[model samples]
Target: MTGWTTANILSTLFGAALFPFMIAVAWGKMVEVFGAAGGWVAGFWIVGVSWLLNHGLGLHHQAGDVWIDMAMAAFVGLFVQSTLAGGKPGKAVPALISGVLGGLLGGLILSIMA
Candidate 1:
């Protein structure tokens, strides 16, 4: 079995816990800069740009390492929260769900290919 280091485990836990807050901040910024619809567009744009940079430029070499994916997810989560939840207190739920799911999906795909 693969042994997990304490730092790795701790970082993972911290990242998971902090994810929602990151999404919230991103959502707030997107909403502030652009309207609801624009936020959605920006979210998609972030994903697309990240993909192009990672694949087109051959930047990502590690499997299952999804820092870019997480950034995309954060943008998307913000978009969802701004559009559907309107930055309400409950918006964090959807934001977290979307961001985590999106990041996981991207990481899984990358891992499979790698």
Candidate 2:
């Protein structure tokens, strides 16, 4: 058995498509649990959990590609939200963390839907 199976492929696509919402949902949970600091790593947490799920399910992703995409999702999701809210690129950890919280929230929502 391997991730190349059609089932795995479809599941991957499904997960990928709903990632935005997942971030949202996850972020809210993270904030509630870890407070503002949780945001710093919430995005990474989602990517880590999601990747683990994929691998556990036997999905095959090529060399770092999955990680790269996941990281991008985490950063971009948060970045956009923060930019809109503050109209600037935050340099401090709090700023980054807050942004990630937003992404986490999105991820959580996606997970619920899925």
Give a tens-digit lDDT track for model 1, residues 29-80.
7877888976797567644555554444443333354343444444555556
For model 2, where is the 10-residue window of minimal lDDT?
58-67
lDDT of 2: 0.63
lDDT of 2 by residue, 1-114 (tens): 343667656765565544555676787789889988787688677666766665545343434343435445445666666576675664656876876898799878977996
Candidate number achieving the greatest TM-score relative to the actual structure:
2
TM-score (C-alpha) between model 2 and the true structure: 0.39
